[model samples]
Target: MAYQDEITHMDRAELEALQLERLKKAVVYCYEKIPFYKENFDAVGFDPYALETFEDLRRAPFTTKQDMRDAYPYDLFALPKSEVKEIHMSSGTTGVATVSGYTENDLKVWGDCFARGIGYAGGDENDIVHVCYGYGLFTGGLGAHYGGLNAGAMTIPMSAGNTKRQIKVLQSMGSSIICCTPSYAMYIADTAIEMGLDPKKDFHLKAGIHGAEAWSNQFRANLEEKLDYKALDVYGLTEVMGPGVAIECMEQTGLHVAEDHFWIEILDPETHEPVPDGEWGELVITTLTKEATPVIRYRTKDITRIIPGECACGRTHRRIDRLHGRTDDMMIIRGVNVFPRQIENVCTGFEEIADWYQIELTRENSLDVATLKIEINPDFPMDEIRKIEDLQRRLEQALKDELATKIKVKVVEPYTITRSEGKAVRIVDLRSEEEK
Candidate 1:
């Protein structure tokens, strides 16, 4: 691993010691430099000065995403603009953009974090790194680009779109490490086949680091089989320095948290209290080393849990399970909470359906309606109308078994649904303003 052994191989005691040491300084700095933190802490009667251990740190008030969005462009920044070297932000598809700034050192830390992630995914100097995530304000492309360069690999800044050109580069350049959103990777695999190129034989892809959207284990397995490469899951958000928070190693069990830079706690979603080590809960993170726009106990709203056992790859920094879904991603259907990931799990189980899918939501006659839209596998015998109808029936039944609610399933022709260059849209809510 590139520049990784020092922290990656640290034992539990050593890693926790580093986390404790940094946690103290991070809280004090946030309280002193960011007035928002100061006011939040003061309002809860939580004194940063009294912080001594993990227990005390938990006493600190939770920092929600709304807190950061409410802060807006630069209000959450801990330093003056003169010191901020770069700025990046979320796409704000859910709401207003949450701004994040970085100092020179912060950028270096970001590079190091992603370099370690790249190494975990088996990226090396001998491999050509192809980064396909969108660039500029979004952190996916640039962060992976930094990590590729930092790892001393020949990095290609593809920055999404132009599928034919992307395939040309993949074949001609012999790129070995591909970084992009999971949905884009799936699209690329489909496109390669449509272009009559065997994904396993034509391209030189050895591994992929896919993130930026939630995908099920079924999706990853199907993707790996299609591309004949290791599909590693890398997790992050713009607020937490992007694409570098947790990275799945070749072992494929779970993602190792960057414990030296982050302190994570899994708390129950409804109660907001720490759960047992192996229980599912919301992931709350504290930026232990970030300088420019640090957040303490930021509620990620991501649903995951700590894996109980040790990873086979020997990375001692604790692993968290791949996210099932975000709390914000949940929707109520027929008195049951339905998540996009649950739909994905059910849809991907069938070989007749393509990986691409979407859910259409609307309100009709004072009742909510949700429809699952999936594309048929192009190679499947679509001329068999009976088979198509049978597939749809099975899908509806499987969905009801999984979601405990009947979700209308409609199978469309191949390539009917839009392909994504970045994070794929899972839900298309067409509810009227009055209905909402």
Candidate 2:
């Protein structure tokens, strides 16, 4: 059931040697072809040829999202436009979009990585993969589609939206595998119930591949219970070839990085220095085998630490713990820092609430105020206003205890919160608009 056993199960020493060789070549490629990398290397007084040991990589400057935007569409591409076969861009919610280009060979590498991930999640050619991730500009749909095809499975490009039809397909089409954002999967489960279809008994799904957003273990338990399948987390971004950068095997211990293709490092966000294994820090990646656009020392801003030991699945590639939170996504409210995932953990811990919630921050009298709007389960005692009020009071108290700050907790009826077919919008800060 293993894909590319030679590379996946290679000895740790051999893998490191391979990574070092590829790292050197990537450095030389970027320096020679991309003006941005060339200037960066010059500024750092680094010689691409002198990068003998892995430690030497630290000399190169870090690549940021702003750097990608500054490079614009094609300035950072290593290969000519004729050689680039595919293009994708980031969501661009925060600022200008970061573009990524891929050659045919790069596409093959991406497919291989995803195939490996599919295998890790117990997929085979006999399974039907229902990809609900949005198609086109977003990488999730096509990434999952290509991987399913590469693994010899029939991929159903359902895309996103049209929830009722999605449920019908699950009942009639004989699909066994599902891929989408975690929030969307939960939404699907909820919608199916509204349609009078039992998610556990009516659907043919056996496993699900969920990512593109941070989710808590409590959410995972809820998802598994509702969907009647094992929910596996996959990690990737459009900037680094999407959805197959790392994935959870059946063991579910940690996400196994595709080290043969990507060289990963955990670095302190402030010091920009390498952190010890199992310590939380930003994830930095170097593309070893990418052709069209190879990025060196790309800081992901995702907070996670490397797991020290080999996975029980026997993959030599190191594992990364589930993301804690992104440095940029952390919110400062009334001088107290809070992460949306922290609120999610506390909300999902309760059984009376649905798996949907939104965090809103606003300015009142020059002070920041946080409000959490949660969706109550439809089956909960909605007829009793006093019970609902009591639950709201309990939620507010629980959030205060966890966040160490008073927060407004408002509970709404089922399906009140806006659901995302792609990445969920959990936080909405109104301070900027109010100030302006």
Candidate 3:
């Protein structure tokens, strides 16, 4: 591909040298402009100029989401509001939403990152990019739009919702690329079948870039079979410049981090110490090229381990395994730590179940109980009571083996669970409501 020639194929030594130079500049930029960073560095007795190698970064204090929230609107921004051309905010599910300011240059860099991602997914100038990510306030929409334009592809800012119209556009406009949450992609595939249109035959889509939520390999396979397109996983956070942070190339082994733009580190979540390569830990990122809001050692909390070598695609950037789950998203149920992704992996692995599922947590007689409500595959013989019961028993056993705890598996009819146009909500915790 034309886009894979330069930085993507740069020498490993050359890439590291470039990263070190950019890292020093980014540190100096933050220390000089952002008071939060300056105070933290001063308190720790660390000087930005003294950062000679990547190892020196450890002396700097870590920046958490809480730090961003405490900074709020503009405290973390390195540039003034006048210089910032755009602003984006986090979903604020945890607490106060984090605000990200972007200068014109920052926006350009963002577009370049997404363009690289699009190219990695086999996108080119002739393709029509249909963006279904939610626009306004959310970064996924506009971020993708910019990327498509950057790739010289015809960009469509369809945003989210109105499933029927979205399908119509896909068929009528001959859109070749789709960008949305993986759950929404499945919902679209289901809706297309209901409309009496075969997604593979009726649409011109060749690839899908899915992110903003965690999904399993089985889910990806199901989507590919249904939509007849290559499904690529994209990873990003609103606070970290959104969906272009890293993306899975055609290799599909792991997501290649944009090392030149963002430096990555894997740290033990509890100890705050670096973990060995290939060991799962929390992901920490430092923005190297961002001018408006340069984050230094921002703790992403997403868990994944780095792949030790270069990808077959010849990209010098390091790749991280698919995210297992977030540190905060781990739930303590009946003294057993469980992540939604783990349950998702187990549930989706069953071919008899549909892609949609919900994990409900409740307390019964002072004991925590987990109920896995999944949709039965529409193709399954639902009328056969014996087959349904047998499937349920097997599913329950699989969940027990994987989770190491007894769980209730409820198989619902197709389309029983509420569908999401944006990020899918998989967990519903009623323990807090019950406590009250």
Candidate 4:
């Protein structure tokens, strides 16, 4: 597919050529404006401009989550605080928040990236977008808000929660597109059905942009079927910016990163070295053009590949596959590494289960116990409780067989789990005995 804009639509050679010039500028900007970068570069006896090409990125020290935490508020910004018009931040689950300031021009670039993403997912000027992410501190809400307006669409800044209100606005305004977590969309579909509304017939939705949580392909397919919309994957983190870092197009093959805005590299987790394009590795990004916070080789920990081949949709920008798992989120149970997606994949295989499930990790008998509580549809026959029990037994066996570990399964009433508006917390670990 042809790219949406001239600057973003450039061919690989042209894009890379443009990036080199921007990279040089970014390096100089960082050295001049960011105290942390200036001292680091000076101590290393390295001149940021002397090193050229993407490969030279390795020469710079890799940035980590801790760096952002240490920097706290404006330590990493490449411009004066007076020039910044807005500030965005990480959730600060670990106590210290990583805040990034943005100048007026920076906000324009952010809007442009998100607008490009909207178009990639088949948005047009006439579309009405309902942004269902958090508004303040978090990046998703405002990012989508600006992008929708930038695309010349009627924007609805419906910042999450109050499902009834959200549905009312969606119906009253005739929203054409929605941006939220995939699970939230499913929850909305269920609520609409409960309210005697046919989701497929009542809404004007043509497409949905879903992200902020790791999900399986089966989940995506199911969401498309239930919501009657083309669901696309969006990828990003607060450290990098927000949801518009990269996005999947109508091709639905993989997410195309904005090469002109950020440089991406995949590295082996163990060695912290660059891996081949197809190999699974931790994602590292360099802000070739970021002015507020320019990060060099910042490790993202999310696992995926960068597919360099041209997309059928015709965009020349590199595409990164949907995240499989993250290094920090990987759970180690009895020496076997487990991912939430693996559990999700296993749970969705059961036809009777409602696809909403959570895994609880607790300690008992001096061993780690994994309990999978899943919701089942109400239509399940009361007389066939034994049969359903047998099915649960089989499911438990299947999970152990597939995951190479034993796990307990619990069947619960429908709609038992909490719905997430932002990123869902699916795993709860209580291995206190083991830790002690």
Candidate 5:
């Protein structure tokens, strides 16, 4: 299923060897050019110049998001600002923003990384690629744009918002590939329906590249049903090079990491020790070829396990299971741990609910309370009060069984919840300072 291969189909031993070579080169470059990496390496008594094997990476000090924030504007750049051509950064609404820059070569590498993803989605020059991710500061929009250009496709820079116009463009332009967040894609489908357009028939979309947030396979299936196209996941973050680190091919088995460009590892979130494949752990990564701002052993905080064995698609790169959830995203309710993903799984399981759902947490009576809000599907028997009551009870029971913690469920009328134009807000915590 792989497109003509020069790098993707490399033999396992050959691929690992190439990875080791790039890993060493990047480590040495970072240690010499960036004082930040050198200081961290010296503080940990880890010698990057002497690193001979992948195991040595375990000894290197981690680069956290806080570290990037502490460094602020340009402290982490290995190259001077003059040499850096472009930059992208996180919203950093929570704290100081994390900025990543790219040299000329770095930009090319970013495009190359995402172009492989386009190939995985079966995209070619004949396809008209429409990119709807937000532009400026955010990486999703430009990342997909670069990929489409690299793949020799007719690419459109339709960066986010304007759902009505997006649908019209898709209909008139005959767009075959759509790139945006999973939530925005959902909004586009709903808007098209509101305009009395059948997304499946009216749009010529063949694939949907959805990411910028964690999503479940059940949600993916629902998207496929609405769009009538194979839905794929593209993984990336601004801290690293965005939207090209990994992607799900037609196999839809797991997301294949671009091992040649990024070294990925699963580690115990608490202990930071490496975990084997098939066991859930925090994700850690190191940029192998980034020139402007290379990260060594960056702790992503996201949780996933590696998929064992080779992919049927013939890519030597390893694949990781879709993100289960983030450690920071976990909440304790009634002395029990719960993840929004768990609640989402339960919500998506019921056939009588809409694709949009949210989890809200509040503190009351010295206890943390969680409430799940879901919208009723049009197909649900809304006229029957008994059926509605039964559905609500069933959802509550399903949440209890899934999380082993009781959560209140509120089933509201369709279109009651606000739709998202970008990354969906899945969780809302309103607990005040004293409540915390």
Candidate 6:
């Protein structure tokens, strides 16, 4: 039997008819069980009977991350806690957090979705998949673990932080498929090279699935070259049922959304209105298949465009481009939009600079300033302060040209910045002005 999303390849009437059924049931489910939904529906003068199709979804209030946090423990759950078999919370980078509960069936649904994602990326029963994302409260490790198992691959549940040991396992076990955040994967590839092992030749690895943190095309190409694998982008969020929500096939066109299971909308962040197809906007998701903790029109701050053309891979579900940047993370500097990925790309352009860098944005003397602290390669000449100063000045000019904003670049010694086993925080916005 094919996955639910495959139905979109069917006749248009058939696909729409199926979606109509799911949307109707989801609306009624929310109206009856979730107090927040019930109140919002009443305030909008909407009755459950009125929402019989996907179009009626616009009448419902959008669900924000705050709503999930407000509900907390079990308020978002469509079913009773007795049916909830697992709970996963979002990694809090800001204020109150959102958590998701999974019923036994919900786990199976995710496993199936991930299994499909893995298969699309060339994973099979013969491959040994090493999942390095942290376990515990975070969903990446378990998501990859169960997905690998469901795909019938040999599963390594090596959670992140032990870099040296992970390298040994990958080398000794002859692992074929690796799964982790792009940064950790890069670190592992670097570790293997440092141990005098050519990662491409020493390992039988053929594929990698990378996500959890935003990355750039340059970083993706670097990792692919280091590991000698076709790195496929995987996307998900804890609030939306974790990793494997969408994936890129070998075509590498963009990530295909599991549209049959989740209703997705691209909306203007300020107006909360759906944008025309092919436009960039915040991604809003409503879980059509989830039972334990169902959400309706949850606004995901992730920014990406939904491409609707038929992919060469034959998947009918729509594809979303690799995230450009988050709506929340887009920094305004002198009226120009700047992203951390752009800064990293600029730093990596110089061989003399190490990858360790931080971008500090602050206000001084009524002008916004961006200070970039980058580490210099150890091989640089010791008695070359003038050369180093020149390189710094050149980098500042290059960044100013690329980002269209004035920037200050400082070159520090090697190993000056802290290395992380997980996602690295690169941006620090420090303005005395209060956020609205």
Worst 10 residues of 6 by lDDT: 1-10
| C-alpha local distance difference test of each model | 0.90, 0.89, 0.90, 0.83, 0.90, 0.82
How would you encode candidate 5's per-residue C-alpha lDDT over 1-436 as one tens digit per residue?
3333578888889989999999999999999999998888999899988889999889999999999999999999998899999999999988999999999898888888888888888988888999999999999999999988888889999999988899999999999999999989988998898889999999999998888998888889988999999999989989999988998888998898989899998999999998889999999999999999999999898989999998898787899988899988999999998878888888877889987887889988899999888899978878889998899999999889888998998888888888888999988888898898
What stretches of model 5 exceed 4 Å from their correct place? 1-4
lDDT of 3 by residue, 259-345 (tens): 889999999999989999999999999999999888999999899999887799888788999899999888777778889899888
Winning candidate number (TM-score): 5
Relative to the true structure, candidate 6 reaches a TM of 0.91
- Candidate 2: regions farther than 4 A off: 434-436
TM-score to true structure, per model: 0.97, 0.97, 0.97, 0.95, 0.98, 0.91
Question: Which RMSD values do the candidates have, in order?
Answer: 1.3, 1.5, 1.4, 2.0, 1.2, 2.7
Q: Arrange candidates by TM-score, descending.
A: 5, 1, 3, 2, 4, 6
Per-residue error for 276 in candidate 6, Å, reads 2.7
Clash tally, candidates in order: 0, 0, 0, 2, 0, 0
**Candidate 1, residues 141-186: lDDT per residue as tens digits?**
9999988988889999999999889999998999999999999999
Q: Per-residue lDDT for 1-436 in model 2, tens only? A: 5666668888999989999999999999999999999999999899998999999999888888899998888999998899999998887877889999999998898888888877887888888999999988889998998889888888999999998888899889888989999999998998898788898899988889988999999889889999999899999988888889998888889998999999998999999988999999999999999998889999999999999877888888899998989998887777888888888888876789988888888888888888999889888977789998999899989988999988898889988888887888888777797462
Clashes of 4: 2
Cα lDDT tens digits, model 4, 1-436, are 2225675567778888888888788777888788888888888776897868777767777788898899987788877788888899988876798887787877877887888878886787878999998899889899889889888888999888888788887777899889988888887887888999887888888889888898888888888887788899888788887888899888899998988889888999999888888788999988876777778778998999988678897778889999989998887677688888888888777888877788899876666678888878778763578977987898899899999988788887777788775666688776674462
Candidate 5 backbone collisions, by pair: none
lDDT (tens digit, per residue) of candidate 6 on 173-292: 988888898888888887788789999888888888888888777678878899998888898889988998888887888998777788888888889888887898889888887888
Off by over 4 Å in 6: 1-13, 345-354, 376-383, 429-436
TM-score-superior candidate, 4 or 5: 5
lDDT of 4 at 166: 81
Cα shift from native, residue 288, model 6 (Å): 0.7
Worst lDDT run of 10 residues, candidate 4, spans 1-10
